[model samples]
Target: MKIVVVSDTHIPKRAQRLPSRLLHELRSADQIIHAGDWQSLEVYEQLKQYAPVNGVFGNTDNEDIIRVFPDKKIVNVNGFKIGIIHGHGKKMTTVKRAFTAFNQPIDCIVFGHSHIPYLKYKNKTLMFNPGSATDKRKAPFYSFGILTMSDELHAQHIFFKSK
Candidate 1:
């Protein structure tokens, strides 16, 4: 299975449209996971047009988004348990959510909201954050991520230079 992950796309505020490069990956990906702060329903619709999308609502997201998404979601993709959450509150809060909300055996945790991409593993848990797609700070970069599963899982962070 192949999945594209992105977050913090504060559309219309940060960027008018997604990078053309990202759109190409979206078309090729089997699934897309959006971590949050989407800022517009159109963003979601555009993503869905490319592939199936799994998303979580961020703190900045509206009530309609909240109602549609749980604070945490567990998805099984080709036997890999992937946990999705828009990390809110504090650092500890998100850590706690990972332990309590995701009780099942998980292969990875995908989260957003610091607007900084991170990939780390402690013990066996893989934690990933794709950063802000419409980054207002730090080199004006937009990014997303990709996870590929075959014999094992492979992940990469993709950064795009905004012109």
Candidate 2:
């Protein structure tokens, strides 16, 4: 499966729309995952044009978004259990919160909040943060994530200097 992962769009607050590069990437995605901070339903509607999307809602999301999605969720794809969260709160770091959000076994965790691209292994689970496609914050590049599944799972960040 070709999964495109993104988060913290912040919509018109951060940018008027999804980055053009991100839209281009979405064209080839088999599935899309948004970690959170969508801020508007328009983002979801936009992503649905490419592929089925599953995600969590962040602290910045409005009632409409929260009503449609949870604060955390487990998405099953090709038998791989992936945990998704916004990774926001008052305790610990964003990664730490995501690492412990789920009480069950998960092959990977996709989360965002700090707008920093991160990919690493914690314990036995893969921790992935696609950063901010619209708001890179202090990161050098705007970024997203891609997950390829076959005999094994592979994940990589798609970074670009321009939007």
Candidate 3:
């Protein structure tokens, strides 16, 4: 399966729409995952046009988004267990917090909040943050991610200049 991962789109608050490059990836994806900070249900609706969207609600999301999605979720793809969270709160780093959000072992953890792209392994779990598709924050370029899963899991970050 091919999964396109994105986060912190911020929609009309950060950009009027998703970057063309990101949209292209979405169009070809088998599934889509948004970590959080979508800012509007419209963003989810737009993404749904491309593929099935699995997401969490971030701190900036409204009640409507919260009602539709939860703060954390776990999904199984091909034989891998993936945990998804927005990763926003006080104290601990987002990565550390994501590691503890789930009770059981997971093959990968997908999270977003700081708008900085991250992909790393801790203990045996893969931690992935696709950064901000629209709001790159301090990052030099806008980014998103792609995950290919079959017998093994592979992931890569795709970056491009913000328009």
lDDT of 2 by residue, 66-139 (tens): 99999999988998999999999988999999998999999999999999999999998999999888888788
lDDT of each: 0.81, 0.93, 0.93
After superposing candidate 3 on the true structure, give the runs of residues whose Cα lies further than 4 Å from its correct spot: none
Clashing pairs in 2: none
After aligning candidate 2 to the native by TM-score, how far in Å is the CA of 45 from where it should be?
A: 0.4
RMSD of each: 2.0, 0.7, 0.7
What TM-score goes with each of the models? Answer: 0.90, 0.98, 0.98
Expressed as tens digits, the lDDT of each residue in 1-163 for candidate 1 is 7899998888878889888878888888999999888878888989999889999888888887777767778888887888898888755755555544566678889988878777887458788888876773674567789988876877788887862
TM-score, cand. 3: 0.98
